[model samples]
Target: MTDHGPQPVERQLPTEESRALISLVRDLTQREIAPTAAEEEDAGHFPREVFGLLSASGLLALPYAEEFGGGDQPYEVYLQVLEELAAARLTVGLGVSVHTLACHALAGYGTKEQRRTHLPAMLGGGLLGAYCLSEPAAGSDAAALRTRATRVGDTWTIEGTKAWTTHGGIADFYTVLARTGGEGPHGITAFLVPGDAPGLTAAPPERKMGMKGSPTAQLHFDGVEVADARRLGDEGQGFAIALSALDSGRLGIAACAVGVAQAALDQALSFTQERRQFGHPVADFQGLRFMLADMATQIEAGRALYLAAARLRDTGRPFAKQAAMAKLFCSDAAMRVTTDAVQLMGGYGYTADFPAERYMREAKALQIVEGTNQIQRMVVARHLAGPGGAP
Candidate 1:
């Protein structure tokens, strides 16, 4: 059976402008992104032009302030936009999310002068960004990162390697976290380093199972120097800034997870109805119908959970716990739903001839990125039962 793309998702946006914006995104995604997703992903080609288009179209800067070339959309609206893009292509969606995460340290914590000088181009000047926090030995335990930034006169010298950095080599700027003092979280500090900074290099991109279109590689900061003016927030406060950014980043991951699950469900629905079994459409069978039902239900639940957390963030409420919960639930649900989609498709699902297999592989990464589901659980538990688990 020939594949049609995913069915339209009904969204609950806050305003007419937001609805129009989503329509624009949907049109752009269909015309530019979805049509080439599978082919480019298979070829492992990073769509830098598409990202440049996204930046020029104002999709890349949706949730940030308008004063600095952002779209000034609320988190609630911006996240739904993410869901739609992700449903089209995870590389574009997650790349936008990581770019937004990279901007967080500056938009939320940088000095007014810093914002004016850098935020505009970074947001809309066709510049891609990456976040550098995790290191070779510090994945989930980011507070234990070993990258060092030593103050030398007015310039700080950064020296160490960062692992698993998305857009590692190609970004225009990097939000880097380095230890400026002793060990642990309190010693850390944040810096906005130019992508072409001296002594900064990226190893070859790591071969990945999925989302191969997006590069993930180790960044080597071999005595990369930064002026004091690029420092974000107070010294010894980088870990807190990273955590704050992650609280919002997790919501982006949640929205992307829901998008993948929805895509898988749509694929399964289309495939089963066209493929017949025993002289009847496979979708006519009760067993496959139940599977489709479960997949749809999970997608709906994940959509709701992530939107709820986004609303909480938009309303200026405490949403760290809810963000962690959404990330954990949605990623797990995506994994289950995508797996079931493959099962419902039978043997055809296991092959690259179908998108179900790709969706399933992509879903697996969501459970591990931003924060592993295990780390998300710990974040939620700490919020619920205190850090010491003393109720």
Candidate 2:
């Protein structure tokens, strides 16, 4: 259940270093990650040790600046690294993506002093992080969030409940968005809160359908006090900051979706080639063969689409539209590909002994992470033809 051989497609890397990095990541996946993926996921264990290993290997800081102890790799290389990790285990892949999202505020919007002070340890240190944006009432309608942060002279008190935080209970830091002024997007502010702040606490991890190895819970900031210096950006700019991070985070999710889809396709092809039907192998059947073709095609197309968006981001161009399209297409593709893989595997796919069932279950979360498929469509629509067709 833990094994996934080489992918059918060949990757194009910009440098030999990137190629070497991918090779190292694949080796680590097979030895350290894949061997325990099924057992740990089944037992609902989070592999903090594996994350520590990644941090030590410079895997955790691939996309940040080298000055801050990051690898300074392009988004293209960073995302492919994500695909390889997700291919091994979705829990690890998505966890790394969320940690990257958590750092976006500090890396992009923090004062230079803040960056110099905090980013090196976060980028290279063995500490994990989480992002706090959604609330009980504000999953998609983020501007409707009710979490409040009030000024008290040199300090600020944050009081809110952040729902669906990926590393809620175990994170060492949280990049939180809270209301600082009024009732809309413009009033929001971003803050960097330490995990052990006086009033910050996390609820028990949610009982999820898949990726149970990763913790997702509601974080309660019961009047957590932070020094004014901990503020991430200007007082009224958090929503913008959050949206910016999501643009990049959506690409991470897309890469992960492709990884899951690719793994499913590889398994289905292996199964069909080995299982015999009548006098010939199951792969000889045109009907099942066409299904495999479609699955592989979607996986390749999703990969291409995400890489295209990542390239745009790497070149410092506007990629929100492309990012949304990639997320919408790739996540949908993962769900479809995994579902087909399960169907093609027949009874074996439905059983726990095979990984097709687990892949299918994990694929469902990709469609809903970062942004729901419906939201992605809305974003693309807004890009192509302004809101309400006013453009």
Candidate 3:
């Protein structure tokens, strides 16, 4: 049999159904998502149609409840699916993850009536979502957010600017975190606002260093009115809800980082075998061979780290510390692996003609998203050494 490059990964799925699902996702990636990723990203365009297709195919809502039209798959299965999609294109994989995060507040904390009212359409009705939490002043220090939501009887008016929001302008709905009480974490609240609400506007998408196909922008909520029913959870409960979503969201970012690293390694491996150096294949060089080994090792270690964290979450355990570790390790490893992949190609990798440079650019954003590696270390240290105690 002819080797068509690196074969598909053999995933450890919980069921035959999950195995079939991965197979379908892989086929879809090869046939649909992979072809235009580079060109589309170069143009800084968002593929809303592809997202619509994934939603229609039920791929976008895999980790949520089947009762609300989700696939009800475990995080392990769902994250592996994310890895596969991300290998094809980071935009799709990360977008799905963010959409799931946006849905988390309502799914986990909303009233039954609220769930029944919105979950079906949000999960399966081809409606994409954006998560709004990071403000211009509150990127890492999320609790210090200054966006305020003022309530007058039954109506709430939100006024503030949220930065680095994924799918900011194009999302069908946004899950917003705004100050509704006094100060600190307990004073915050989350609201589900429609994207087209009056006085809500988005700046032009940011000219990012990577993941250009994914629209990231500043969202301005200027007297945006929402009914009291749109508030997620209770007063003083928003910060906890946001943290819960972030813990899960970090896993998604980790999985996507692994996928990008794997893709970079695969490209380097294939190119080394094909390109001739010193009158022999480049793969024949011991120096190049060792680099490939290290890249593969980093990818494996990252995959194992994220999967272990996912298993913990799937089994109803506290996995926050592990999630932070996975996010820290995997995203940093991606930056390392992609940078090495670019080096492997000598001068060719520096140009956009090959995908190495593109992968390198994309890996960078993962290190900053979800939370910075600095924040991840802080989280892990707090869990490990107690608050502010490290020897």
Candidate 4:
């Protein structure tokens, strides 16, 4: 009777089935997503067809139960798929990640009836979801959210604004966290609010420096009514549910960061080999080669971090801290790698012709979202000082 921490019980590294799935997904992403990604991103249009492809491919629901028409794969495998998608088009990868985050509330804490009600559409092609945790004043301090969900005659009336909702206006539903009691984290409660629920209005999309294809907007809940049945978990479990979902969501961001870093590295490698300077290829320079080596090392280390965290999650271990570490380390590495990648390309990297500039923009957003890197450091530090944790 040996104890294995969050490693998946049935995990195997890149099995034949897994490899085949990866190959198919990679081909589809590269062919279908990469070609038009720049244009779509530039135009700020949602890649709606890409979502359809992902849903049809059984990828949008990879981390869910097989009973719900999901892939039911381990987080380890699912993250690799996320990395592949991100390497091709980060916007699509991010949308998938956000959708996964929204599903976490229903999947982890919802009643059986709630699961049956919401899981299918979420896992299906026709619907997308948004997570409502951050408020105008509460980004990292999610517990400080001011949104109120008051119980009145068996119905909950929600009133407050949720800021920075990915897929805000476009989502079919939102997993909302509101203050059901007093102040602090304990007063919070989670609910499922339909997009068309009366008094729920989404503001116009914010103009972001990057990840423009995946819109971010504020959700205004002005006396929006929801049935008591829409509650997720216990009355005060919203904060808990949000944290748990973020632990999983952090890993998704880590995978996407790794994908962005890998894309930058691959582009840098190709450009350095072909771009001639000083009577030879730029890659021939020992100084440039060393930088490339560093980039490769960072990418591999970041991948390893996320894989370890994913393994922890798959085996049902306490992975919140590790997931934070992975997200923090990978996003920072991505920022560094992509910046260096842009430098390595000399001039062309800065241009929109290559994907390097887009990678740079996309990398910065990951560092800020899913809990900022500063917040991630705080989580890791807490874990280090606690009983049986990292130091």
Candidate 5:
């Protein structure tokens, strides 16, 4: 594996502490992640130890409150750390994002007692988590999910399957949404399910195109019981909780997309400069130079867009529209930039010997996850217009 150390990204950190944090992350990524990323990914290995290290180092808890053993960093700082991690390895970066998403319900909506009991262990106790929302039949239409949870004397029994769950089988805990009433979003409720619960099992991981190291699988819940105390919010509020979590999760996807794009651009730059043509390095040619310029511009713009949205979130502002825009724009930008990176490298880019192909494959997944790019457009449109799209 070619250890192309951390590429220089001129970050606008708010504090010296954050700058030092980034420097620390870069050092960590260079030392631990980047070196074995390709080899482990190729072998379809999930780096659970790396996640353990992150939890031990407090990287896993950056955006949450310090009262619960979290890092107490703002979204702005937390997301930049995500960007740095993603630049090293998407499996690690997006895994942290999904873990954060899994913790969202309890952090944002759980009662004080719930936080006191569960938040600290979740945030920093070396536990991995998964978010369960999408099902096999209900991907885009999440409200139509068929997962049913029946209440009986202070206990809820969940029986259904959740699909496309990242870290599905390996997660220590799962944040699950199940229908408790009639139908649609209003009938749903959220629960924190222990991974070791009886009757809860996971299917084998999906054979994916990229991020092969990250396990995506279907989770089965057959009579999995939970205490009423584990309920996240009021009855029939799970859909709202899920949507709220998605808003922040989309920003995470945007940051990861930009990170992948930056990695591709770095590969293109390195390759073009080293591989020479007739008289000079291919990077010196006008056409390839122009391509590199465009790639860099797109990456910078995507970074700025995500950071802008992160700032809004950090400041307690209505940033849903901007979050959708950032997810859509940054993911689309990642697709284009990765494709261009491959093109600039010509035949070499298409081969497995280089990381460009892997980056391109990984970029494709970002457009589809956390709501597809088309769904993002609909979200942005709904924010701009009314529910019926009337401006």
Candidate 6:
């Protein structure tokens, strides 16, 4: 029953270069950070030191162009790095993903001059970013955002509260989406609001059930002034920029989901083998062995789905639908696989003695972030139907 046949495709090593980077990341995660991840989680401490190590390694901006000191790696390569880091610690993996998402708004839409101005500190490290799109009254219905930005002279004054900002107070910069015209997505504009901008205040961190180490808070912008030069893309292009960035951001979250599931699966496998039940190793039993098999199968499917989307993106095709599919399927798979991992561990999984419970909690957040899975389904469905088609 414990047949280790054909080693599932998900566990296979990547190409030489990818394998090298993966190995390096895995070693860094396991050696430098894993030991402290649990304790930090317990104490609700975010790993600033870990972020410094990642920044020093030039991993903070791996997918950007090399001209800006970025690694210029492919999404495929970058995703694996995320997976490894996440397997060791969800907080670091998610922080990096959110930071990357925060940067995407500008990287994808900013002018050459804007890129020149911001890419250096963003890609060179020491500065982190956050994406601000959601508001108190608008979430999944992002187009309904009521935050307003009025142009006065060469500066624009923004007044709004951005809810659920990943790096709300801690980020060096924020990519904020605000209404510049009438209602709806077409009226929105995007801006690069400095963290210390006038009237920008971070609300106290929200008390979440998991991922306590990755802070989530709201940004209160009371007449936060930003130069017109700081605007990203042309006026009214905010929705397009936001959607495009989310297409890539969803893939990052998918990678994180896979990583979380993988960690849970690995821990369960190791524990079942070493954790005696009845007589011989519990892994020797057929019933529990089937559970392991299911976990492996689901994880492989989830990875394949995201990789397919990533490849589609790298090829410059219309990959929005595929990205949504990956995000939805992989996140659901993570929620299921991690839950099963916890179940397979029986009582210990329910306790802090094991990481399975933590994995379960972490997996849940992935479903909600980067556009909730419900939003992902809508995106996919819209693509499936032709333009002007019914929902």
Could you say which candidate leads in lDDT?
5
Candidate 5 global TM-score: 0.98
Candidate 5 structure quality by residue, lDDT tens digits, 1-391: 2535349798999999999999999999989999889889999999999999999999999999999999999999999999999999999999999999999999999999999999999999999999999999999899999999999999999999999999999999999999999888999999999999999999999999999999999999989999999999999999999999999999999999999999999988988888888989999999899999999999999999999999999999999999999999999999999999899989988988888899999999999999999999999988887577421
Root-mean-square deviation of every model = 1.3, 1.5, 2.2, 6.4, 1.4, 3.3
lDDT of 2 by residue, 234-343 (tens): 99999999999999999999999998898899989988888897988898999999999999899889999999999999999999999999999999999999999999
lDDT (10s digit) by residue, model 4, range 1-391: 1111111112245578887778788778767887788888999989987887788778889889987667888899999888888888899888999988998999889988888877887897567888999989999888889999999988999999999999999888899999999989999999999989999999999999999899999999999999999999999999999999999999999999998898888888878888898889999999999999999899889999999999899998889999999999999999999999999987888998888888999999999999999989989888887544432
What is the TM-score (0 to 1) of candidate 3?
Answer: 0.97
Go through the candidates in order and give the clash count of each. Answer: 0, 0, 0, 2, 0, 0
What C-alpha lDDT values do all the predictions have?
Answer: 0.93, 0.92, 0.92, 0.88, 0.94, 0.85
Candidate 6 at 212: error in angstroms? 0.3
lDDT, candidate 1, 1-391, per-residue tens: 3556667888998899999999999999889999889989999999999999999999989999999999999999989988888989999999999999999999999999999999999999999999999998999989889999999888999999999999999999999999998987899999999999999999999999999999999999998999999999999999999999999999999999988888889899999999998999999999889989988988999889989999999999999999999999999999999999899988999998888999999999999999899999998889877898431
Q: State every prediction's TM-score relative to the real structure.
A: 0.98, 0.98, 0.97, 0.94, 0.98, 0.95
Query: Hey, what RMSD does candidate 2 come out at?
Result: 1.5
lDDT of 6 by residue, 44-95 (tens): 9988878878988888989998877688888878887887788788899888
For candidate 1, report its TM-score.
Answer: 0.98
- TM-score for candidate 2, please give it: 0.98
lDDT of 2 at 380: 97
What is the lDDT for 347 in model 3?
89
Candidate 1 Cα outliers beyond 4 Å, as residue runs:
389-391
Which is better, 2 or 4, measured by TM-score? 2
